[model samples]
Target: MKHLAERARQVIPGGVNSGQRSIPGLTDLVITHAAGARFRDSQGREFVDYHAAFGPPLLGHNDPDVSAAVAEAGRTVDLCGVGVTAGEVELAETLAELVPSVEKVLLTSTGSEATFHALRVARAATGRRLVVKFQGCYHGWHDAVSLNVISAPEKVGTHDPISTGILPEVLQATLVLPFNDAEAVRRAFAEHGDDIAAVILEPVPHNVGCLLPEQEFLETLRAECTRAGSVLIFDEVITGFRHHLGGWQAISGITPDLTTMGKAIANGYPVGALGGRADLMELFSSRPGGPAFFAGTYNGQPAVVAAALATLRKLREEPVHEHVFRLGERIRTGLAEVFASLDIPALVTGYGSVFVGYFMTGPARTYDDLLRNDANMFIGYRRRLLEHGVFELPLNLKRSHVSYAHTDADADHLLEAAASAASLARGDVLDLTDASTMGGADAHR
Candidate 1:
């Protein structure tokens, strides 16, 4: 057992919250140092990290320029958390420039806080209480958004309670609808449209393992939210600065009233930003009639903001996403071939830099499609991948992160290991239901 696990278990709850890092057998391999997509675990095992800390390290781990910027900012942090910093304004303005819809921006320490404050603005601006969210699209674990992330196995569209600690009053304000179902959205709006303060969602649903939105669904959401006088928020915490300098909204071209960004903005540093049109942001303005007050000690830490500035500047010039997309597709296609060779039912999801393996029967278009996959087998595959020096975690597993540090060479190496891991997992599945334990030398016979 990794010593960190024993040490961490005594202090941190769950040892570690990152699903990929906290595997049952191998928290010891949980990485001590990382740079440019490769990590060295405590035991000196190496891995091409795919879970870029669940979605932030867009510039890859330990980028020199970002590190330098953070260092430079350290010199001036005498002003950090002291009050206002030019670094904050610069990062905010940078976001406004990159994301055309963002005329004003606010910073927070984490995505949950960003969403929490953004939601407050949404409600106070509209003078409404209801908050709409799509099932399987996770915004954050905040009380307001902690419900109905996925429907129950027996039913679609019905909201399933995820966390029990959420207050009943908070749950009452949440309205969870099935993803990509415009009709369900329309019906919700038809009933409580006027009361819905905002509709917050991940444009590309990553919570259910990197599921993409159906064609025109995002456009329809923007249109619906506008017509209903409710704000639209894109929780791009995972997507921001991920695929490109513009991110998913830039690529998708479906702008929301507000967008929450973190993770990759600073390449693993803690930073989150809420940005949107000036008028909507006016709700957070300090005026007496404005929406609410939002502030934090580390909300705009110079080090993190500087890191973001460096990452963004690099993204504009380097075009690393093209490489990430190509490598991502390579991994997906390679995994498909591996599954086909073994006749294991599985599929790949995600675009550009991010990708996820769905151990399901068919394409994971909706939550129902996701149900056809074998969760246990996926978990087993995750364990085997770690054994093979290719680390991975289940989608149902808590947030995992990956980045551009992985090269084509790394992708090939991972796929080669994945083929063996998939075969091993298929063997385990065979043992589960048979009398003969007949998943022979090759297993699944």
Candidate 2:
């Protein structure tokens, strides 16, 4: 792994293609191939694959159905000059049928594109400039929604850009606030009701360790957005197909005006979709000079659409959600027990097949609660888990995912690995509550 990382650094900007893979105290593996719930590193070591391609491999790596579908498309479909294939139309129909808030669909090639277009549509439809996004909620890498996904502990409500390239006007247009803070949402709406184009969030925030949305918090956003005439966009890229067939909107019973979906929607394919009320989505149409512009060369590319249709159909027809939910429950229970028995001050937060273990004392309700966990200890624990052949991302402040391919045996192995890792992590003595040692809980629940 180290050798490959070194080689990658010689060509790639920072050894890895993405910044998340370049975390300290870890060597990112160069994977050869993956199947079911395990993948082999370049050195031929197979690890139980809990990373799940950062959430897209919900049905597991190279699922036979998905692979076959892609193969069929490769044989029968064209990559260029196809001009609206049946696969794209079918995939759009499937999305409209399955996702609860989707009355219409506009396909994109990536999650970032989906989010970028959604924001544009919101701004165009409402004739407003400002957008409301909560702290710790990752929409994508676009300049409009780039700030505050993972900022410093002191920068929670400051609308600070996570990256250096974002413009000052972009930061000013975004109203960053704490998650689960209803009063803050109300206050923001009250103050900028006229200027706020949309209020966007991850209904079930997983980027910062599967922070579930409080019912009141979601309801508050819905009510305030309606009152303020602002579009409510749910960035369900990660939670889309992972949580339910209809995404988080189905579970929460509070639908957003626009929903951006990707990642798990296609079960590891490069695809993204923006869907919402027909009126809002129509803003993208060029007919009669529709205000918002959305264009992409690879929008609804045939092979990806084929994989997505197969994945979504399998998710809809089979008992996939039930099986994964059972595994998630077992993990949550087992981790709590492991931490209690080990006498480790920790909190496990998640819903469905997504979870993360934070070295903390109590429940985590917001991004600030998440920031209080000991990063160094968590990093060590993650490294120990990797040593035990459990393949979760080596980052501390991120979520780990389980997939449909993970069996009962895989869950048991994960529990065992976690227990061993927790024990190995005990030697690093650090205060879990001290803000200086651990990032302080900056916001009250």
Candidate 3:
């Protein structure tokens, strides 16, 4: 495994395609193949997968239905960059039908593109340049919304851009505020409402360990956006099809002007969608006399579209949500019990099929609250679990997913492994000088 990881590093930056894939303490693993709820590594070791490839594979990896659909699509249709395909129309229509606030839809290759186009449309529609985003809610890697996600404690309320290459004006145009703070939303809207083009958020800030939004906060955003004529965009890339087919808007009863979805929408395929009101979505260059420019060569490749359609069909026909939600609840409850038994200060949080274990006291409703989390303990516990044949990302605040293929027996096995992992992690934490405090030394280790 180390030899392969070294070879990968010679070719790819950081031995992984995504920066997040390079965990600090855990050994680098090369997965061989996957099916159902488990996968085999290069060493031929099997483990139950809770990472779910960062919340894709909602129906589990290598689902026969989705694979067969992709195969059939490959045999019949391929990319036709010049004109539209039937699969594109079907996927767009399916998105419009499933989502309540989506009157029209556009396809993209990734969530980042979907969000980028959504913001562009909002700016063009309102003729404004500024956008409002919460501190911990990550929209994408784009310059407009790339600031202040999982920021350091000192950089919490400041203009903490993730990368250095972003222009200063781009960072200044984005207003960063705390999540679940209705008064903050009101204050921002009162001061800069006229200049604000959009207010984008992850309704539930799952990026920072599932900080559930207060109902009043969402309501305030909707009301303020309407008053100012600024577009409201819910970046549901993490919560969209994972929570409900209609997205979080249906569950919250607070509709936004636009919504961005990806991840589980296509069960791990490369596909993304931007959907919202027809008047707003029609601003794209594809429409007759529309001014906003939008173009992508691989926007609706036939095989990817087929995978998305198949995933959606199974989600509608089968008991996918029910099964995954049940497993999620069991895991969350079991984790809480395990941590409580060990007398560790932790909070188990999630909604639907997502779960996160934060080593903190009480509930976390905002990024500020998450500052109290014991980062060392959180990572230590997850790394220990990884050693015990249960796979979850060792990074703190990253949520774990439960897929449709996971069963009650798998949940039980996870809990049992978690018990042992927690005990070992507790000892490791005790060895640290500042074990009881946040930001302990070597926290990432």
Number of the top-ranking candidate, with TM-score as the measure: 3
In model 1, which regions exceed 4 Å deviation? 17-21, 27-30, 150-152, 285-289, 394-402, 429-445
lDDT of 3 by residue, 218-292 (tens): 999999999999999999888988999998999999999999999988999989899999999999998978989
User: What tens digits encode model 2's per-residue C-alpha lDDT throughout 223-340?
Assistant: 9999999999998888898998888999999989999999988898889999999998887863456778878888888899999999998998898989998999899889989998
For each candidate, the alpha-carbon lDDT, in order, equals: 0.73, 0.83, 0.87
Tell me how many residue pairs clash in candidate 1: 14
TM-score for each model:
0.90, 0.94, 0.95
Cα lDDT of model 1 by residue, 134-240, tens digit: 87776666788876554446645554555567778888898988788888888888899989999998887776676778757788888889999999998888777
Positional deviation of 59 in candidate 1, in angstroms? 2.0
CA error at residue 373 for candidate 2, angstroms: 0.7
Pairs that collide, model 2: none
Instruction: Give per-residue lDDT, candidate 1, residue 298.
Output: 74
Flag clash pairs in model 3: none
